[model samples]
Target chain A: MDPDDLQAEPLSSGVPDLPPSDIGMSVEPATEAGAESDSSDTSSSSSMLEDDLLVLRRAWINERNSPELYTYEGAALENLMELVDFQLQSLDAQPASIQNDRVKYLVRSYLRTRLNKVEQHPGYVLREMKERLSQAELEYAEGFRSLQDAHVRKSFLDQFPAHLRRVDEETKDGLKMVPEPDMDRAVFCRVRTTVGQFQFDERYVSRQRRPAYLVQTTNMQCVVRTRSS
Target chain B: MLGDECFKLAKEAKDVTPDHIPAYNEELVRLVTQESRYLWRRVVELIQATESSSQQSSSGVFSPSQSTSKPDLSSQPFSNDPADVSRSMESENMQGQVALYVHTIERNKRCLMAYHRKRAEFLQSLLWAVHLAPTMVPQNVSQRLAPEEQNYAREYAKLNMKYRDSVEATLCPNDSLDWALNGEVPPRDLLIEVRVHRDCGEIVTQSGIVNLQAGTQHYLCRSDVEHLLTIGYLEHINPT
Candidate 1:
């Protein structure tokens, strides 16, 4: 599959999953409660569909690039999952299955990426962080920590000291014995704006090529192309 | 000397062959944990020594919560007081030692976590790698795993098998075929050219059973031959 085709979607970085309510209404004001009027209806609905896909793609890239767990794109994921699964039920050898397959692959990759990250530091993610994981992911993390704890007890108890066995124990100087993401790690990005005086970090940006000023307030329309190293 | 075992453990994990699991260094893990225990004991001793000095120097100045003492007060507060200087100096020395030991212990914990997590991930990916070939981790590979990892691998394989079967059933209940284990995205074309690198007796395709002879070429429907390409019976010869 040409990932570039779905590259219509923008990557997220703490970006909200869906466009804000006002931006959504402004994008397609008449289509919300409009009846089955054929001409304008199809066009509006297709455009809305395109917008939804863009948000989903953004979530995909954002999830891919972030060092730590980005915000869960819960709403976008729910909408895409329902739409693809519903389409896939009667999808008898149709070419459209290709697109559905792409969606499935993206969702699977996104979820798996998060799952791998969670596995790497289950204790840290569960105990130190908040709201970055979905409810399902949180439960899985809890289960994983307990499972590993039980496994460690069964395997390493005889040799390991009792006091040192606790992985999350803090030291006397208040240093936590847990893995943490390096927030200052360098990341690559394809920038189209001057990005002068970024609120997060001024040094992370410098150059610009083509500046397209966006007046809309939708966080889902992420203009930056993440090439995070 | 402080974190030498941990340093070696991380290096050993990285030095092994890329595609194989390394032997678990249980001895190094024990030594590191033991190091952490000793460091903690030393820190506790330092804290006690500093706490006693703080009490004696402060004289009649009563500290309510005497368990945890704070050296947070700057030199300006103690500059005018003569007795405070000696206590502050002693506390400063102990705090620095405690800080260094604490950082080393945390570093040791991270190294230990890195080693185990690396081995665990290798076990997880192995299940997927051996899916189309042999189902289970062969006896030789399983022997290399720690006891906990072996159990993890068994449980993970079972979970993957269940997930694959359910997904296949949901996708194509009547027709028995695969929904995954293909190219990342399904190829665009229906017909694809393939080269047979090895000799195989016969395999069924949509047209009919084709004799998969050695060094033969055929333009078969992609659906009929994609699985063969995956299993190394055939290779997809891209048209130039």
Candidate 2:
């Protein structure tokens, strides 16, 4: 069978063995009741849906711009893209009530599509961070190997410890070693932070005045004076 | 509220199904309803706040008596007075928006429930397939399953003969797997990639010992990792 033909068929049809009540009747009453009660609550809910739509729209735009979204299985991605397009088109053609419903579905599908991209896979930021860390490690290893060969190193620390450290470690060590290349000296220099004098005031100062205390004299002072006299 | 009732019913139905498949249908419905309700309340608050502010600003130009009556004006749902046509129009627009939102929520609830039901049915069918042909449980099939799903499939396969016979009689005869084992040739062993989600030491397979660690990916025969996949410790990855 053609792959396209399989896509056209409802994917849910794969499981048709469920009891009629299990699949159908059990759901209808609850939804109808929900719809009825929802009417009473609609005034309040309408504004909520608008906010949800706004967030969903923003998310959809972000997904479209995301580079990782393209990595999704071709058929699923195409289907979601088409669904979004259809929803947008219908928004104009339908009445406000219908349009509102369509917008919710659109937002939901958009979220699901975005979710499908990352559901099994790790988040884009995490994967990117891992890749960057690995690349940095590889670069550091390459730099260390090259430095070892140039300095006739034995232990890991001996290769570039003292004079080599003065030059920016990020640059080629060869340029720093040979003084003839004065033009490249600027590139080899490390950028250092300069400290300036800073003044700081005490955070807390006591505002309350000290209490006065009366001094009491004992008979010992008079007795001593009399004895001396 | 209605979503909650549906969720309760779905949960009840879950008890009738096999133990292995996690009953996520109820939880999904509950989450959707809860989220929708919170959003609805926020929207109402926003609309009310904006309306009250606009009334306050507009009332500043009017007399004290009219200003005093502003609370009443806000309380009234609709105004028949011709002078307040614009206010009435705005109210109608808001109502329409609300109606649209309610309809959308109801539709979403129904769709989610249907998907849940379908998923449960699919699991039942998969169990039936396992019961019919234990050996035909392909390596790729096991690898595709999560750990819990594998356990569930295996556990269901181990049900007593009476239960299996009853399931066989009731199960729909139109499943694609009904004819899976009719062919003459023996099933060939397929090489597949399995990614360990959790650490598992030296699994002895027909081929050799396969050591697994979290975040490690390995290529092995389908049979070696089928149990691991079903139990959710390992996930199947398409070979790059």
Candidate 3:
């Protein structure tokens, strides 16, 4: 028998077998709603086919550069490399989006830690900070949980406004709303309730004058601060 | 992409049934495959040639048996005239260049091991991919196992295992050195000599040698730097 007479398909990434819905339909966009609506049994079979294809594609991608698999030649090897390059290009093109989503959680984490500090620190506004902080904490948790089911986590983060610091009447008339220098710009958003919308021009500065958005607006700044020792 | 072009060529390049190929375009496939194979083999040959030259220089400096087994000639070799062949030979007889010898020996052993391991793995995977092709093999393995390929596979596995240990042990020392250099070097006693320099409060070593990976100038040292190379403390120094 000749060595060049066989036929085989590529392998898939060895992901733990997932539930049918996640492993199957989620890989590619569902193209046919008619096929889905006509028969549940047929839908399940088509879903399985999609699942198998995903498995095969993922396996080939994972092993593309692995020394354990394909090399620098042949059609299969070339296809695997092309797939990897495409994924890499996609990743590069969406850095801001990915970072924005990540920063959303990081901001919540930062605020949670700060709220803990506020609880420990002594001040007249501590009580007000504590109340708003607790509310923000609850909202952040709820938002995160809801985000898990969304199309993308970043858009969910964009919708979350709990990390914003509200300029409210606590005790001090003058206030400083300072943005964390290292905070990711993507997740950092400001909302002015008095204007009934988000504000772009009103930057976070370490001083207080009149509210920049509106006369009686609830000006909120998503800022980070260092706890004074 | 090159892949698409190749695929189109393969798809449209006339029927390669038993009537067309070298025994079914067998000879053409073999020639293309062998051309790539020969390119890599040429690379290995160059590596061997360089290694042999280094070994010869070392042997000229000192014989291996004399130094590892004997102790009388260590300090005396340094006195020989660097220009005189007879004196150099006598010096080599007295004290072998054990340090250079050991370095080269270890290096060659590592290179040969890497060469074999990489070659085997590449061949194994390449063959595996070819086997998976639509028109490549018969229906069953029993019919597909050519005696030569069977032997090649066994030999590949053996070489793969043999060199696997060496490859794993051979790590680049860039990261650890970078950490140490960054934290301790500026204020420490170790003087910056040769190409070592400080950047952003980090001590870094640089040398001028071509790098194999990415063929890019790495930030660490040149590829030919003779000191202990580990991935932990070494990085390639990119010119830019």
Candidate 4:
């Protein structure tokens, strides 16, 4: 995947489908069954399809690596959906309906990951980072939050006095009730481009060289993966 | 014991191997919930005292030490000197204890949430894996869920379908698209041979009805047998 794709690009159109060919897959022997497999198993898809697939892959990798949600790629997903639906209806392409499944699987994974993150850090997502979610995801977030609030209230919070019923406030420990993602945690990275130098913790001076970078993941949104390397 | 019960529940929630769902720990959950309520009540009592006292003074709500207002009503009934410096010190000490109790209560809440959320996640995944067919959930799995958890699973399954339909609404609507179907690796061949492992009775496939008595073999579309493959009713026959 191109490192440049990590930088913010103009909103292309639709959901950048995930390549969830891995995690949560019920079937076995699942390894990189993505674009390369798409090409090998069938005659080459049109260049446009290939391009859309690349965008989807880039989106998938970006969402997979980053702790924070990126903007949704709605246009690319819509286009791919039309194409996959077309292929499914085609007489010859019906056998390759597996292609549609792959696309659907990837898209489902992308959405699922976002949902996981939303559920994990609802306070942060609902307050500071809502712009990153698509319309459907936004609705899901609001609904899930209310669902949670209702659950918490019905289950135990109601047992407490009205003042203590509040769940999202800071605790007496001076820590937040809702945990935000720990950005300061160290994350391993591979350098796509060399940087001359950057200060670490205002104490140590370090230089990033090509092929590897082991920096704390805080605010380091550009998670470039050197898959070919 | 303040955190031990919740910590144990959290550890069990994370086990992903050898089938994810474990039988609900009803007794422990009840105990934890009771402890949480007890601690939370204490915290509220302390905080309420703090709030009432702080409202009379100009000092910040949390900064009981920096308080300049006279500590009149804060003195204990048994105290000889109601205005003594020790009176303010006592309130400060109470504030510190409140902080500790609040921490314990919140931590307890987090653990409880983690356990419940983990089970909820498992339920959602199982429902999706079976393509939203609740009846397809294995009997052992169904029996393990708590009654309340069972209700949550049913409601959540319905919500999940609506969520998927809304996701579909983002795309063209004419052709029915199933996002949860065949969440497996794309097979190189569209059709594969499979041997029945158990008596599945007569089952209809994409082709036609086939009796799935033990040892019966048939070639079927991978998608057609996908559910059976997951449920262990049939075994994939790899052609050598």
Candidate 5:
């Protein structure tokens, strides 16, 4: 449990050899029977293995789930290294008994492999997120450029419905209207109305009367005024 | 050693020098390139198969046996077989297939870049940790690194040293501590406001166990409720 002792030894010295058993397959019945026979003698060892497994599993899960970055400072890293060292020592002390339990051996190997991955998981995620962000930025830029190109090629009227175009045309027509004088009398004229030609008093047209016009053009009412002398 | 045997076997297989560990860069690159090519072919095949199947279905001449007799694409070993390559190339769907292949390659390249970037960052962090606390650097962390990663660590160390003084001046105390430790500063006694998202048991803290309920807000030190925040049971509210 001494940190100094843990730090003194090279980790390569503690690393166990590759398990002979294939991880995908279930443990052989012979190994299981052997494990059961020596169960009483190795109770403490088994419990320690179980404890180490739980801690490592939790650390692995946390490494996967946590938003926080992984580093060497955490209790999990220390605990994992310590457990690995312990497992290596046990394997050295009783090679036959340790190797006989196929399940334990598999767990140890799997744990070792996972520890490496777990340590690197945070960096992997950070890199992924950054690359994804850059990709998104590129997409955004492309989208913006396309939008600008579309906008530049067509006016708002051409891009939208005909109704908006008509409204724009009417507004331009309204703005173009001016009082025309012919010898002090105003001349008023109507543009593009469906109503029959009718005479209205100059005062009525000058007052901007609305109900007096009975013409509907493009679903909109239009009033015409001209000044005449 | 348990795991050391595996490395030894791999090293022997690769015929690496005794002093130099096998980085497996060439092997990984070859494998990835081959796999991508295989995947490209598989995708093209799948698309063509689906297209032909749909055409047959529409023509009211669907044959289940014919579709079933189609070669198992997954089992087909990837090779530079001229016949297979030429056959795929000659299809009228070549344009679409080529486009798909290009897109797949781009995505694969991006993934590889991300992986390398991750490794680089990990090495940089490791180097920084080693610089700050040599005793704490685990032997496994240092020994297992590839040659490229070792180079990355050396480069990062140089850059860090160059910017050390300037960076220290600009960084907040907490950030400075984090940089020095090469990790996040664990929750301590800093006061924080948190809103409960779900009902739970009272949190045991240095002061006492404080009752928590949904839709309730509490002002507590960070150390007392850091776990709750991590688990999404509570949310930290910024004072600003």
Candidate 6:
């Protein structure tokens, strides 16, 4: 009945365990049983249960209205908390029942239904919440890693080493060629920081057609040859 | 019906003047659209692997082109009559109708998937809401139901649970909601009863409290009454 009482309590710490029988005190016994005399008693009980349920429903609605990013686990916890609020509100909103026997029965139903759900699917909410939190952490780490890598760049020439070499050749047509390097070309390329390797070979045809140059290299690889424009 | 309509217009083309080309054009569009629909359905069947024959014919390869690439209608030679040729040409003009169908089906399938995903997300959220709500009990618990009503709910639950395997067969032949909607509407109020025991207390098995607020009339329109009735407050019936 009092919103203040609920709001005053620290909801984040989790809901306090409620006395089972006292949760829903508003449900009235069915009219058929005590139609003539106990109508008031029935109404009183029903009203109490209804009020508490209304409050619980409101709490659940509020929790659900959270931002788009809240995980299902958090949502589930919010739901459970609201449900407890609904039960408490139900007790205060409706008049207390005179029929203790009926009240007991109704309370037992509420507890059984709820507790069964909790037991049947134990720790489901907790697991979901933890998973969402972990996912958020992972995403954050990925973003941070990406940010850290902003300065990193692969050598532009590395992607197309052959193209870079061709440009250099076009700029300066003739370079010294020692037809066959007297020393191993590999050792020279490795030791000299500025030295880069280039490969070329000419296959001789029967002196009838233009000799085709066969060029290959580990320096650059292309899935398909791109013809220079 | 569209195909039939097109067929009628094509036959009457001889009687109408050349100016009545508009009528022929309209009929052509309808015919092509219908053909496209047929092609679309077949293509979808192949793509979804719903065609048993296609699945059995090939060990593992899935090629829609094998099933749908050739227009089945193409093989049906057009009548020698110039009028028939004209009509067929108009129908064919509707832009390789089968191609249009494939495009539309793909788009719709994507939309359906997105819609289902969003709906699932919403339902998940709703469940969470229900879980959190206050400790409230039902507003009313009916007194013991008359013996007859009790027996009815019990029998209904029993039938549903007992024949559950068969229920799938009986409920909808195609089992797909789309197919069910297109087919005959199933029966109303085919009730089933099953006895469910609770740890807290025993609900009267024979009788139930019906909340007038919750009724089958709406669900009956969208779903089979039998299917809807199979769920809810069955074991909670008040016994007389």
Question: Among these predicted structures, which one has the highest lDDT?
Answer: 4
Q: What is the C-alpha RMSD of each candidate to the true structure, in Å?
A: 10.6, 36.6, 33.4, 8.9, 35.2, 31.3
lDDT of 6 by residue, B1-240 (tens): 324433443344343332221112333433434454455565555445434533554532245754455444555563344544554454454435545555543332222222222222232222222231112111221122222222333332333233222322332233211211111111222133323322223222213322223222111111222222233322323211
DockQ of 1: 0.11
Q: What fraction of the true interface does each of the listed models get right, in terms of native contacts kept? A: 0.07, 0.00, 0.00, 0.30, 0.00, 0.00
Query: Which regions in candidate 4 have their CA more than 4 angstroms from the true location?
Result: A1-45, A92-94, A172-174, A182-215, A222-229, B1-100, B172-178, B181-186, B199-211
Candidate 1 residue B141 Cα shift, in angstroms, is 3.3
DockQ, per model, reads: 0.11, 0.01, 0.01, 0.24, 0.01, 0.02
Q: Which residues of candidate 3, in runs, are more than 4 Å off? A: A1-40, A65-229, B1-96, B118-150, B154-240
Across B18-97, the per-residue lDDT of candidate 4 in tens digits comes to 36688888787777778877877877788788677656543443455644353546445532343434546767988888
Report lDDT per candidate. Answer: 0.59, 0.39, 0.30, 0.64, 0.39, 0.29
- Candidate with the greatest TM-score versus the true structure: 4
True contacts kept of 6: 0.00
Per-residue alpha-carbon lDDT of candidate 2 for residues B27-122, written as tens digits (9 for 90 to 100) = 554455555555466456657865885685466436575445545454466443444656656666776766655544444444443444344345
Q: Model 5, range A1-229, lDDT digits (tens) per residue? A: 2222111000121233332133212223323433655645455544444454444343333222322222321233233334334444444533222222233333233332333332334233333332322222223323333332232223121332222222111122243111111222221222222333333432223222222222222111112111000
Which is better, 1 or 3, measured by lDDT? 1
lDDT of candidate 4 at residue A141, scale 0 to 100: 78
Report the poorest 10 consecutive residues by lDDT, candidate 4 chain B: B78-87
Q: What is the per-residue lDDT of model 6 for residues A92-199, given as tens digits with 9 covering 90 to 100?
A: 433322332222222222222232222222233233333433232333323322221221111111122122222112112343211111211111011111112233
**What DockQ class does candidate 6 belong to?**
incorrect
**C-alpha TM-score for every candidate:** 0.59, 0.22, 0.18, 0.70, 0.24, 0.17
Q: Write the per-residue lDDT of candidate 2 for residues A1-229, one digit (tens) a residue.
A: 2222111000122122333233222223323333554456644343433344443443343343332332212233233233333333444433222232233234334433443333222223233322422232223323332332322222111322133222222222232211121111111111111112211133222212222111111211221122112
| 1 against 3, candidate with superior TM-score | 1
Query: What interface RMSD does each of the candidate structures achieve?
Result: 6.3, 29.6, 27.7, 4.1, 21.5, 24.7
Question: Per-residue error at A1 for model 5, in Å?
Answer: 63
The lowest-lDDT stretch of 10 consecutive residues in candidate 1 chain B is B177-186
